[model samples]
Target chain A: MDGLKKHIEEITPITNEEFDYIKTFFKEKKVKKHQYLLQDGDKVTSEYWIVKGIFRAFHIDKDGKEHILQFALENWWFSDYNAFFSQKESNINIVCMDDAEVLCLTLSGREQLASEFHKMEHFFRMKLTSGYSAQQRRIISLLSNNPKKRYEEFASLYPNIMQKIPKKYIAEYLGVSRETLSRLYSTTSRD
Target chain B: MDGLKKHIEEITPITNEEFDYIKTFFKEKKVKKHQYLLQDGDKVTSEYWIVKGIFRAFHIDKDGKEHILQFALENWWFSDYNAFFSQKESNINIVCMDDAEVLCLTLSGREQLASEFHKMEHFFRMKLTSGYSAQQRRIISLLSNNPKKRYEEFASLYPNIMQKIPKKYIAEYLGVSRETLSRLYSTTSRD
Candidate 1:
């Protein structure tokens, strides 16, 4: 769990003993491409921090259209946060987009870390602050940005994920039609 | 700043001396309706916590259209959080919709409180956690919900805000045309 240690250290320093104790709370899992991390109606007991690979958490609407909520790549943390925090059944699904490794931390473990270490609480707070900032940007983009601008913003924001994920999923995430995304992609590629 | 003290104590109790010290870090301001708390291109140095009245933070597009990013009611906190956190110029405007009073806290003040008191750190973290969870739910709603469903969801989720804010602003926030929102409002009222 060097990556986990490194991730935590990125925000705040920890002693060797603290790192070892913290490591005990996380469990590692390997997932194949197309495997589901979570599905609708499942209770979310843990939130995952990506160790490697790609995943998409999405909701399928009544019309059977898949709406992508977010894409998680290496080092990113994700869960159906609504369900995870409230300990309720999820209304969404998380599917591995590529072969992946993730470390899971249960709610109790997370609360324990925060309560046990001030530094850990600060680390988690910093992470949430950044996440909140990003989500605010997303909200404004959804409220105002055009398809071209949205695509450009998404590409610029997550360049690596842009390249790794399929064009169709990008199209869905941007709330644009596949044809529109295709045209934009070709134009972008040409440029 | 009794309200501020109460708000903080709602999460974690503080001693009278601690409350007095904390109050020094916050500056209170009274704003008239239509006055802008923040405008596009202005540097955002502080986050505001509302004590009275309503405000809407928005961006004006190149075509001269205003897109509401969020509405803040009493007890809500807001800013161009991206700019506020990074100490950069803002890309949005926050204008008062009603005569309002807000307490402004700079990044340094926030950090000082967090570092000095574990409970304060926990309080801020809990606020961010709730904000992050709410944003995640918003991302899904924006990606999947139709106009009618969006309006319904918004009303149910914030019935108080729904009553206080005008329908047109609610329409903008929901990303639905005013006409569409009007029809939905009338239908609901008639029912």
Candidate 2:
């Protein structure tokens, strides 16, 4: 909870009263390693804010091949946002990679805070701005043909995530072959 | 512009006074077809809100192949958002596909309006939410192995843009071969 206050304060200063009210909207939960947080066809309601742990959000194809959409680590937020926002069934699955605790906020709760507090709205807007920017960069990288550049980018932008996530998952996220990733990793180490 | 005012009011209603003040932050510009609104290595300062027209934002690869990132149509906003938000040099290019009119708003102006009016902040936040959701869907489609499914999804989501944009550009955007797109287009039309 103190960390939540610190995180919110990083974007906008919220006093004791505001923090108290805001914190009530979020309920904390513990998650075990390899547990399923969400699954396909589930009605997504709450968006999770990671307090500690790692998780993968992915979509599985008919052939059971998984496509990694994103990874959530400490201080990151994750959910099937489209489902959460529109109150639709989830098309993606989120599974925990490590034992963790997360703070959950329902859509109604999120809206209540935003509508009641102008600063909360600003904070969400700023966060989305950065998220939007990151997606644009990822799209560009996905379109690029340079495998080495892509690997280097992932390593540079998310050193912590890179270290935590396995090479196979990293390759899947980068749209690169496992063999190619291994070669790139060895090459990068030599360099 | 009444269109801009209407667009904003669709989410939140505002008075004549507020609209007048908000409109001043945006400057309208006429764009000619084939004109470059933004180019690689350029400094991005503003995001454009299309009043009328069609445009494609893309990246050029080392092999000199162009990859379409997104298409902007009437009421859509487009820019190298990563650059726009970070005040960095742009790696993407936004070119007008049809003669169009757009309202430009700088980052400073955007922040000013958000701070000055709570409604504006909510409006932008809502816009970003939709934008983020759209990008997530796009990323999923890109990762999917079924080209036909990808083509079908695009056609369904942006039927208007599909009708307006040429087959070549649509093919590039979906990362499918031009020949495959033509076959899909013909198959859909004959249905």
Candidate 3:
């Protein structure tokens, strides 16, 4: 797909022949709103690249409280990467928030592609580099106690995601209460 | 250098010749205890692989509270990766907890090695994969309000680090108070 091409090319340029070959490793899947792409305890065999739609990955604690881990939008990659790489059962669930289409690559296929192509490996490494940086930022954010600062940083960093994701989910992601989020939102809008 | 070779081999096996070539990119640096390897606002130019030391990477907030981002022990990689990869000024500081030796590789050197050898690219990707998963686990721990569970999980996952790091820093890492960490340690030891 053109989206896949654009996404891959954002990190490394590929020949038309290479693109055609790389595309073969991915299979397309579709899901409807409220449907689950992955559930806890399932073997995470594949990592996905979103072609369209929004999805949330979360863990439900023992007390039945949902802790949002991350959200993926179009062109973003998503997976229980811990399970995917270790070939273990997933500890989290990913559900489609909007009707979606995704391209999936199994673990073996991913490894094969990376080994067979240097640029592909470069592309994956660069993507992981960015993902690692984001996680580090998230850790710093979670460590900070100021919810308003967290809200402002989240909005500034992901204005598009802020607009697209529901306020309640955003509140969960920020580890803030709905009332606090609403207040922050009102004040942010005023500023 | 043997440690570096072994570290890379843990992910992907490499020939002696390749390992030698790869080792050339890295330069060794020694740091004394309490010495800052990197400071806030300093340009992050290199990522370090610990040879023989413990180090703490942390951010100091406006209220002058230290929030431990991570700890690096022997054979572990450490960096303000967000700043290192982005080539930006660091927002955090990395200080030696023990007199230590580390191998430092610049961004250009790292990129060159990855491009020059597919195995090196695989090596980097695999390391990032593990790092990303650890960050996800940390995010989950941070979101969970139960300090006992957090301490137990951290101790189980990093027993060596638990022994090597000071209790106060561990408390900061868990986002729990030192008093709570002391109780957890006493309970954990009794158990």
TM-scores across all candidates? Answer: 0.94, 0.96, 0.94
Candidate 3 lDDT by residue in tens digits, B1-191: 89889888888899998888888999999999999999999999999999999999898877888888888888898899999999999999999999999999999999899888888888889889889988888888777677887888788667767668787788878877889888988998899
Error at A34, model 2, angstroms: 0.7
- What TM-score does candidate 2 get on C-alpha atoms? 0.96
Q: Per candidate, chain B TM-score?
A: 0.92, 0.94, 0.94
lDDT of 2 by residue, B1-191 (tens): 99999999999999999998899999989999999999999999999999999999999978888988888889987789999999999998999999999999999999999999999999999999998888887777777676776787787667767669888899888788888988888887788
Provide DockQ values for all models, in the order shown: 0.77, 0.80, 0.83
Candidate 1: the clashing residue pairs are none
- Give a tens-digit lDDT track for model 1, residues B1-191: 99998998888999999999999999999999999999999999999999999999898876778887778888888889888888999999999999999999999999999999888999999888877877777777787877766776677656767668888789888887888888888887787
Tally clashing residue pairs in candidate 2.
0
Name the 10 consecutive residues with the lowest summed lDDT in model 2 chain B.
Answer: B154-163
Superior candidate under lDDT, 1 versus 3: 3
Docking class of 2: high
On a 0 to 1 TM-score scale, where does candidate 1 land against the true structure? 0.94
lDDT of 3 by residue, A35-113 (tens): 9999999999999999999999999887888999888989889899988989999989999999999999999999899
The most accurate candidate by DockQ is 3
Off by over 4 Å in 3: A186-191, B186-191
Candidate 2, residues A62-130, lDDT tens digits: the string is 778899988888887779987888989999999999899999999999899999999999988888898
Q: Candidate 1 at A76: error in angstroms?
A: 0.6
Quantify all predictions' global Cα lDDT against the true fold. Answer: 0.87, 0.89, 0.88
lDDT of 1: 0.87
